[model samples]
Target chain A: MPATSGHAARPEASGPTGEPFLEVDRASVQYGSTKVLSELSLGVMRGEFVALLGSSGCGKTTLLRTIAGFMMPTSGSIRVGGRDVTRQPPDRRGMALVFQSYALWPHMTVARNIGYGLKLRGKPRQEIAARVAEMQALLGLEGLGERKPAELSGGQRQRVALGRALAISPDILLLDEPLSNLDARIRLTVRHEISALQKRLGITAIHVTHDREEAMVMADRIVILNAGRIAQIGTPQEVYNRPSSSFVAAFMGAENVVPLLVEAGGERLRIAAGPVNRAAAIPAEGRRLGGRVVEARFRSEAAELHSATAFPKEKATEDALVLDGVVMQASYPGGVWRHVVKIGEATIVVDSSHAFASGEAVSVKVPAEALFLFDATDCKEGEEELR
Target chain B: MSVLAETAAPARAAAWYWIPRAVLFGLLAFIIFGPLVNLLLWTVTEKWYFPHALPLEYGFSYWGRVFSPRGNAMGSLGTSALVACLTVFLSLLLAIPAGYALARLRLPFRSLILLALLVPNAFPNLPIYVNIARLFYQIGLNGTILGVVLVHTTHGLVYAVWIATAAFGAIEPELEEAARSSGASAFRAFRDVMLPLAAPGLMASAIFVFLESLDEFTGTFFVGAPDVTTLPLLLYTSAAGGNYQIASITALILLVPSIAFMFVVERFLRADVLANIGR
Candidate 1:
């Protein structure tokens, strides 16, 4: 395992040994006939930070709530420290959840809000006060302890919520998009603050979010959930660089997908490019591509666009793919110019440093390493039908 | 030209604003304050003949008489307070849980249940109280303070449930879930987080229940009369007997609780606090 300074050691590389700190085995949750989570399993080490990344209604929040014991799974079991806690309620599960809305007690002052859990546990008044003060200082809410939640700014209220969650000293910390409510500028700073705090405490944390950058920066392992199922789970760099499926590839900022026919030879895979595709031969690399059609995906920034008149006739590399297209639209989105290129019946957006006219013919060059290929039969439900 | 028009806008707007403002103020005073002034004057007046623009004479003798034991006003006042307080307690006990379920749970036939809660207030008071009085007689609860309180609570429950449902519905369930995740039990979460955050709405509903119970007359008359006399019943009997002074004094006594309740809950009635919960 690599020991990084402000981040946890990579959980995937650590490998499985003894029982994990938290184990969710084949958990499935259903709400009246609609299944929210289906046969999901995950294991988190003692001090690892894992992120569940997905779009809305993908069951990331459902999984978080189930792990926190707020929602009971219809089947399967959850174990914490080798003890089955499937039937236990949230209060007895030894975990704290920070809500996206902050969920601060609007009627109580900051000190009282942070001290509520201690008070419920019957801690001595002086001890509660001391712990509350410590949390306030840790979250940089020193002099504002007497102010109510309504008196604080959005960022300050978020800190108070974090302070309240941390003051309890739970075994696991659950955060459900806690920074989503903050403005973009505040979100960046708070993101670092929470990451630094989680590292400092070394508490096992599971953060659920839809923000790809947030997950990449804060989590030791990222679990991409699609339609209540795990699409892929790996280290941030691994998932970003090597997505396991077409859905995972599309989810990881590789939205442009092109279909191609592949014929597997002795050592190389011959790609039969279409009318707008460039023929290329690449090493099989152990990928199972038995299906005739393959879906090739790449990020918009990965493809370099140049005018067709200056394009070279021969291939630059054995793995590189070049495709012919015409610019359908072009616009500048801040730093770079983005062009929508029409190739055959499909359109893909590519980013360029220089501006190109809408009617100009161009060739898009995609490096081999930057491209991801998956069996077209494995395309997610409703996706291939649309194409 | 646009800049000049913008600069001159305030002067023209001010000239016409005062006219509408004065008319609104006058209408409000006439609609709300006129009856209150008349009621106050009738309470203090010793003698005021018909066609008199103002009372011919005024004194505190009626106020003194109402407080004396012979007047039986104080006893009725105590009865009204007891019934109203009990009604508030019982109504809240029933409404809070019902409201929570209605707002947060997926109960079957939810709209039907909500519509059923509104049935009590839809009908005339005479028919409802008569039926309740008959039911109380069969149960041997007629002419009892508990019976009167139960009757008042039935009326109060309808509005209480409606108001409480909206109140609890306005609160995000995430707030309570957060508490539960923080090592607090369900009851603790309700007590520490939900109750406080929903305090303003809950108090407003409770005040409405208290006031409704205090002002209820027909139910008290049918179910509690001849043995248990409440303030509203006393005021009705006094007015029916042509004792206008006593009726006025009884009305004033009933108004005191409503005023005190408003004062007690004024601080918690802040819109900012309620609107900003768990923001």
Candidate 2:
């Protein structure tokens, strides 16, 4: 394999691979009087693929552009390859960006688009031709080099954009939602192709995307951003399974969050779960009193529903927490059945193996570990409380 | 669907609205074209006045008299074309960059510059003509073709900048940003991405400025009286001199280019770009 062929060479250079290839320390960006990003710090290791995942206006794209040197941070610094490059221009910083719009020069052919950066850097004609040819072959664009961007398909235009960024062989590659313009199916295909290509090239990449699944699948680490601030940073599973905050938990597909009152009892904190579910145990460093239950939401797949008469068995796993309710609605979701069961005044959604009719009595067995608990006092459910 | 079918009666009635529209169009066409035909007839006739719609006599002697060896018909045509070309070139060179900067750049006090350009267009033309003639005389550009070209450029600059600025403003900044991120520099971005997209608008502004330079009478008459005789200036002078045939011939010369300019401009006017200027 080509991977093994390259891996056989002795590691070159003295710089430590452990040291961060790019560091954004306490970066704050402002557009006139409005502050877009505030005191955000992030680190990327050599050959690491990090995604700044957030919705629009969350400063994810702003952070990516700042790191590319298109935007100057009002405070703090950016160091790439151990060199302070905060005030450098985009072209001088040796970083290439693949814009969300696939900002290909419509007037130029695929080969010209791919070799534009090299031309700007003053590469000779033959060398540029060879490098462009290499990029075209690598991107599966061998015969389409003569076509303009307007002549190519959406996926092909994106590949040309990627090829252009990669042709420069910059220290880092920045992608600003490059897959956003593609159709959903094409987005998935191109995203996977981009991930494979980035890994093959062994280049550090910072991708900004609002698509949670895209971030989880493509990034080695996902940094969830909320309103211009870093809310959480972890591996895909780590962030999904053990989100430190309710925001991160919800962002990582834990769409269900219920308010809980914590009462400290030795090492295990008893969570007086909410109206819809029974109490559960969670480990916490208790420092506050119990608060009112405000909200409870959980993933539809995480909860289980069964006939109410079938009481909890003595050996229900510690991961399963139970609640009593009646099936308000049920649906067959291919593999498993989904039931929206109502318990008292609250409706708890759950998934079950067997189908149940509406108005049938049921119990929603929510795993204790799967339940995300947040104190009502700190739960505004808006950005103000999250910060 | 039933409601639409019931309303279809009024819609069918509305199709007859074109009857009045056709009549109005005919009236407007006759009002604009009638005097032009009468002027042509009078140019060839010996005696014609308000009551006579057509002439009894006609001859090519009017053209012979107007373009006689002693006449300055060719000289004035040469001057008019030269000044018009100069004005178009100078206005484009000055207006294109200023328009692009105003439209594309987020520069400080851009609205103030726009207001300054608009101020010249707001004032009456005679005051500007008098002031410009005095200024030119003071600067030793009194009766030269260069002086007239300068005055036409001044007048043309306002409308040129206003129209071209609007055209440049209508373009999507995303187009330029897309080019730059794909590795084109600021200059290349403008040349490749912006210029092609804005070609129709540039041509429209060019045609308007060319027509204005060809037909400016007051500025030339005040500053370029005897020495500079542009088409409009000579046409006005011959009319004031009581030689209606010469004046009609010169008017035809002036009218042809103006109509041709409008036709050319109409060919290049892209509804997509021009419609966005107001927005």
Candidate 3:
């Protein structure tokens, strides 16, 4: 897929009579005195996989549980396919959740576990058996039906959980960090399995995960949550390339941030060179550069390093923000060498193919499009930026 | 040379290891089977003096007499079985939901409530039995089978609640949530998921309650004397009246339910159910 910039994927015009499949409007959940979700609103289109991505305690799980009808919003309504199900119980919501722990019934055999929902719906024994067989084959779990969950491997158990959820053929599927418990090797395989199954079934799925790459690779749109509110909601490429806030920028792997001075020029913003940086200008369009002092953030991989003495004869590119720094420490991390470069008082990590010795001076070139600029005062306390 | 040494060393080590194990087995056998052997001999003895090392004669007369219609043994055994079954039923009925609540719900002073469930077992039985006797008398339930069953159920309910609480607590709440999300109603989820997962523990608790109620003596004696005669009370009264052979036979009879319960517990009441539930 070609990368889109700075815009959420537009809801399909023909999506089920022009309405979003699932709508969470102004929903807030309060636990005793503490509010976990504050007036959160989101719209998911039919067949769209929207990921609620956040660190722990960000209320992403709370929002997903609310949509699944496991939790009731203190106020506001949740409408699924044009029906308000805010006060409905989880069983009546016609949704299935693949739990993080793969919560298979330990006492039940694999077939029985997958058929539990069908049995609850009062389907005939034979029909339940048939559907269970079909699900077993679908998840590549043939000949393993009689085995209990404790007898199965982690990946097999995860597939059984998926099969169980899909057995009911619910309108929407909810995933709660379903891959978090698997080993790294198995997690990648199962992650693709879940994504492929969701796409093949065309089921509208809402996946909740703290892993950024998992959400980026799996979801059509990603909702980045911070402090019980959405920091930004956009496609993975848009959120990664053009984050709306410093928090989103930092969370999207832009951990190297440095303060810079800027002045609005005709059709461009002139960046003032500090004691450690060289002056440059970038187009002002689509940038919220109201203040003079702004935080310039870029990913470690986005910055290219050149030796201090080996100056190129060509002038500096208009789009590249060049900064001079002395390498304080260097380490080889696999294919690339990572260095801790000290620029004025701020230290940043820059990755380069070539290793630079410690205390060696170097020039770092960060392209204009790769540099995310946010207001200087927007920096939160205790935020870890230099990684 | 190393292989020879390894083989020789383990043989010597095995010889030394049997010493403590042998002593432990000898003590366990003596502690457990000693009284049982004496009881078995007593049931068949015709007569024996107190200082005699062995019975002077052996006969089947006491066994015959106990099985006879005049002995009232069968009636008392029947009463004991009925009371135990009733106690098991009532205790389980009350404990399943109570245990679920204690394990999963946000009750005020939950630990204190659980501690209170254990209060009956901790105190001396005499005061509790006296209080129960008084309460039963006022309610016109004294000297009746229902009253004895009620008192015995209270005796068994403590263990039922404790075992069921641990069993239900071992279950991951996420399993029930998974069921509910997969279109199982709360009741269906309990029946299909939680109940089956917790069946072994529940069965263990039920058998425990049954055994406890069957062996209950103080409350049954105090509340059920002269009318509702269960096996333990029968054994106690028979022995007090100096019918030693009949008392031994009755004691043997009492062992039936306990032995049967132990068999069931060993066969099904796995100790590792909690540890292995979500693994």
Each prediction's DockQ?
Answer: 0.66, 0.34, 0.77
Instruction: Report how closely model 2 matches the true complex, as a DockQ value.
Output: 0.34
| Pairs with steric clashes in candidate 3 | none
Q: A6-50 in candidate 3: lDDT tens per residue?
A: 134342321232457788888899888899999888878789888
**A335, model 1: CA deviation in Å?**
5.5
lDDT of 1 at B34: 93
Model 2 over residues A124-182: C-alpha lDDT tens digits?
A: 99999999999999888989989988999998998998999899898888999999899
Question: Evaluated with DockQ, which candidate comes out highest?
Answer: 3
Candidate 1 residue-wise lDDT, A1-387, digit = tens: 111111223443633335578988889999879999998888888888989999999999999999999789999999999899999999999899999899887778999989988887899999999999999889999999899899999999999999999999989999999999999999999999999999999888999999999999999888889999888878888789888888888999999988876756557777765666767877776666657678889999999998986656555336877888999999998889999999777899999999899999998988888888888865453244333
Best by TM-score: 3
The i-RMS of every model, in angstroms, reads: 1.1, 2.9, 0.9
Q: Which parts of model 1 have CA positions greater than 4 angstroms off?
A: A1-18, A307-317, A328-337, A352-358, A378-387, B1-36, B50-55, B134-140, B259-279
Q: Write the residue-wise lDDT of candidate 2 on B110-215 in tens digits.
A: 8788777767567898998899889988998979988988888888887778677877887777567655555567787788778877777888898899999998
Candidate that would win on lDDT: 3
Ranking by TM-score: 3, 1, 2
> On TM-score, who's better, 1 or 2?
1
List the candidate 2 regions with Cα displacement exceeding 4 Å.
A1-17, A265-267, A272-275, A282-297, A312-319, A375-387, B1-19, B39-52, B55-70, B182-185
Indicate whether candidate 1 or candidate 3 has the larger TM-score: 3
Report residue B91 deviation for candidate 1 (angstroms).
2.5
